[model samples]
Target: MAYFTNFKMMMLFTLFTLTSNAVFATEVPETNKSNKPIPEATKFVTQHKGTFNGKNLNYKVVAGETYLLDKNEQPTASIFSFDYLVGDEKNNRPVTFIWNGGPGSSSNWLHMGGYGPKRVVVPSDAAHPGTAPYELQEAPETILDITDMVFVDPVGTGYSRALGETESKAFWGLNEDASSIADFIAQWLTKENRWNAPIFLLGESYGTTRAAAVSKVLMDKHLINVNGIIFVSQALDYQGSSPYVDDNIVSYITYIPTMAATAWYHQKVDTSGSFEAFIDASRQFAVDELLPALFKGNTLSTAERARIVEGLQRYTGLSKQYIERVDLRINAFRFAKELLREDGIAIGLLDGRYKIDERDDVSADPKTDAAKVISPAYKAALMHYMRTDLNIQWQRKYLNPSDPALSSNWRWRTAPDGVSWEPKYVNTAPDLSYALRSNPQLKVMVASGYYDMVTPFFDAEYTLNRHGINAEKIDYYYYEGGHMMYVHEPARVSLLTDTRNFIKEQLAQNSEK
Candidate 1:
């Protein structure tokens, strides 16, 4: 996944020329060949029965690879997917394609923690999940009863890999990634003869970015219309989420309400007021007061600046002096470190409920993320489940977070045509708007976590508010946890229920249409 400039490519070519002749002079050793023929695609199927939402459910799991082909129809890459089809009602049942973010991540997180039938049990209150023998259980809250689910792994993730002479980097950019995934979806629908089935997409974090772009691809390139899209911990607009940048005004405005919610959670802010009311106040202050003061820059009057600083202090639970020193713009990372400095603990950016005790307190950013405390348990659980329960026996390693090379080589290009490509903060809201316009029946459900600083709930609202999106077609749901909000049992059940309801409503509406 190494991204190389023209200069680097030329240098590598020259180095290869200098060394190739000498290296190839040695006699090559011959290897034995097996007569066994290689299969074009890998597939493993298993069946199971379970009770969900008071109904006995029977489902089949198809864990395998689907090859993505080039223009010549030669295999380019093997994209891995776990398809869970419920009952024999395949043609009419809704099908939801799900994946997590990271640009390089596999579908493991959402597969194991969110809506899959099998889930890893982690402490709900953001405590450190130590070592293994992690509890893995059947999640009755899964949406499998309402819709079939397919968890897909992109190229260079999970057991997916480049095939033939194709390079893995071919599917590493924004447009390339979306197009390949759309192709996989199209291939899957055709193979299963489920093209008439309602199609929904569920994506988390950067996967949300992919979902928006992929929706457009499906409509324009493949002539496939999406029924709905679900965004879990949405990050459709990077500029709003990236609070680290000093000059990102939208980031500052979008993050204030989340900081206020975090402060309320920690009991640092006054608890006498209702949480919802406090959040509304914070939102108002951000747009009406804070944003104006920030726009004024040095032109702001001393009294006005003082008023804004006081408002920030009250909302963020930081001292007025501290807010003034930072010029009223709170960097999320710094806030994580400074929030509970007196208690010798730093808050997590993903989940502010979790705290970490860094060795040194003076660091600008927290040493580690508190939300990652439960990651080991998740990894162990997924590996064990895949082998023991799902019975997926593969020699290749299952990459959890991602392959380093894939991420490093990932291209950030989002341009649709031959426009001058300049890498900037990725925003796919316009793509989503286009999808909505093209597909009138399409609806979107956005799930946000109160404690998720990485993609603040406010940012989700802001990103969806404009961009020509119909307000009636969108629904918002909020949880009491972090980015991977489903790790919390209550939130998990709530999310599943809300999503199921949304799907049912969408189907009913589509039927009437």
Candidate 2:
């Protein structure tokens, strides 16, 4: 009986070995989904004449789909972009790739309300722009004459989407997003034969974070080094900007100047001098006094604490009682609500200049942001423009801000291995640092809105000043508007001029090199 059992065991072992070897040898043909032939990219080109920067220019607008391929060279997604080209295609005109941030936003904000040739007309003074018969007008302040612009909508935003068997969630993470955008950029350059053109990246809000990471990816993966980067409402570091969390000492320090500016704006603070001087004083107070007091925690002396409280009240316009109750660490959200609470209004986070009358005046945070009031106008303008002017006919629904599902599922992981990811504060300043170091000639222009409480201008200074960045290569531009500074006409023109000059200067510098 033992001999028979031994024979059966040997036979079974041999059978298992043969089956495993056969399975391994079959060479599963790289999954049919990944090996399938990809469809050709869809491109629609139209010509139009427009006057920008006092130049009567004839340009070609290319509204198209660029397919992002998987490792097997199979199409995985269709990324949409609106490319505006001026001058002869033969000449190497500098190209700027622009996108808005939300991690979920479409490029429509920048396209319809910003540097695009046509802009959606909203009230320029940060008023509550009522439901529109939204007027669209020629944006003569556009940078088209100096550089060709391509407004990109990342996968799952606008008309861009995951194709074939690929899931939309695959491109929703930090590292994955940067990699995909970098791939799209490389593909765009290759397809358009614009590899010789000086490439510039312009990103707003969270898009700034993407820009920093993608710059590194472009250099490391494709050996494509960008000439310059423009950060609109820069938010590379969250630790400095997030003011709601407890024990966030950096937030207390960074938000002081912005609060002072807001208070000055609302006349909550008595300031007779220049706004610059007032802001400078607030900065000085934050660094010299507020920062130290916050760091002292529970060990702070009565006199020192009292002095810091007085400084907070003087800068933020909050009463001494409120400051004392909050232990001198005033939350930005609460400040936004409480600053105007007596008047039954709440200030906007995006643009402190805008005010909202919340249903609950006693709420801890503002119910809504006034900057979002103009979103409807932007959405309407972009859809109408795309269909009428660009003549883009698509079955897919155009997502204005983004697909809700994508935003909900967005992975905030900053690192691939997930070991060093900060769940609370997403900081890509180090990525920008690496990129700056990798390409020393790479210039960066930071555009900030004085009234933008979301990504405070002071935070931008804090993030950029560190990381050993070359100060000479960095340029700072400020505007009197909110996060989308271009919404204001004067700011729009000024930012365009600054951008055009920056690009020109960088190109000239690169040529000399």
Candidate 3:
């Protein structure tokens, strides 16, 4: 939801305590008894034709339990691969592996609302649209109409997790993550034997790095081969990524426009010019004028500071007095509460556009990705699907990650580290570089949300550019979305439209090849 924009820190914090503290469902051992080479997939033909929020929902995928086994032939982790029959399961069109970004998030958001068979309803709160109605209707907008979509959860996020006493390390690290996914792909392909089906990767947040890493693991491990990869709010690396430093001043720099956009919706920004024009000018000033001045480190004259304050006030829709009061360093929380605190209103961090006039505007944390305004319907729907639709009922906590009660802070940390590289051990940076060279035809698309503070657009861009993906060969589109673009209905439609067009191009190009 809107909270996903600043999900990086929150997700990491949540991950550390999710499994035990979080109240989501938990995975159990698969119900099938197969002591063979590759355990047979729990094949079942079913349809989810439910209706909610006055809309119809539908799906016709082979919903079943997919498994990956060690040499001893015991169940490791369980996954549900939603196979949409392009023609027949035999025709072999193309298979796209889809996942959510959080190292802790499940694929439900992307699977349900993005390009899956169902979507959660947006609530009425203008500041934060939630599933107040608790409706999970069918989403015909699913890309399954074209490409076969397989939603995956990294090892711990969704139903795809190890059982009690199972080695959790089998699912950790860059290489481990890729190989686990690669193993799943290979087993699925062999179980299904659609060897000719071209593979594409779609990952959001950390999953983007997962996709990049996995493409190589697949090649080296002789696993799945990927054609194109899509990164949604990706973070390839985090060095010099965020401008939101020094408490809140620098964060205010980037978080301001988001604030401005929210303010504009409330008719608060300087009404002197059109919204887009106002935004463009403000962005330019921030990047060109303000940034240089701040980097000066006190070399700036008093007159210059006044000018910067003037521009910040004009663009941020705050009282010039308040702008000066903070010494030009208003953090996002203060900005959210103080910006409209007089009206007894508190804006939602997920989508700054939504506000609630409830209570005193006091925040527990300056940077909060609280799902308070998030729709619970998708979470509920995924739970239901796991039981009724897909029929996996181990149930402890559905989407809980490693842990959450600990003090977890997501800092730049370090490059994925020397401790672990999953699936098959390979250096991440060098491996990605080599694989791209091995198949220069592979193109990457890094999807970023401008308002996403979690995996800032700048960092995602920086990481990919570091990989040296040619600008010409890569497609980068900035959406006015938070982590999950679908949080705003308009953005959802726009993203789907863009995604469909991109897929159509791939299809066209595939035909020529």
Q: Tell me, by lDDT, which candidate is best.
A: 1
TM-score of each: 0.92, 0.91, 0.77
TM-score of 1: 0.92
What would the per-residue lDDT of candidate 3 be over residues 1-513, giving only the tens digit for each residue?
211223334522331000111122222233324532333334445544533224443535565556666665566776655565545557777888887655556776787667776676764333444444466665655566556777776566654556434555556555566778888888777766777887888887667767777888888887455677777766555332333345423444555555565566666776767877766676677667777776774788899888988888777678888877766765555565666666766654544555566554565223433334554666666666556555444534655333232113222222465755343212244455666778756767766554444555554544556665566556776676666666666777667666666666766776787
After superposition of all CA atoms, the RMSD between model 1 and the true structure is 8.9
lDDT of 2 by residue, 316-398 (tens): 99999999998888887678888888899988777788888888977787766656788888888988888778877766798
Question: How much lDDT does each candidate structure score?
Answer: 0.82, 0.81, 0.59
Lowest-sum lDDT 10-residue window in model 3: 15-24
Q: Which stretches of candidate 3 lie over 4 Å from their true place?
A: 1-44, 47-59, 71-75, 124-133, 163-165, 223-225, 239-244, 247-257, 319-330, 357-371, 385-397, 400-438, 446-451, 456-467, 478-480
How many steric clashes between backbone atoms does each model show?
Answer: 1, 0, 33
User: What does the lDDT read for residue 87 in candidate 3?
Assistant: 51
User: How far off is residue 69 in model 3, in Å?
Assistant: 3.7
Model 1 scores a C-alpha lDDT of 0.82
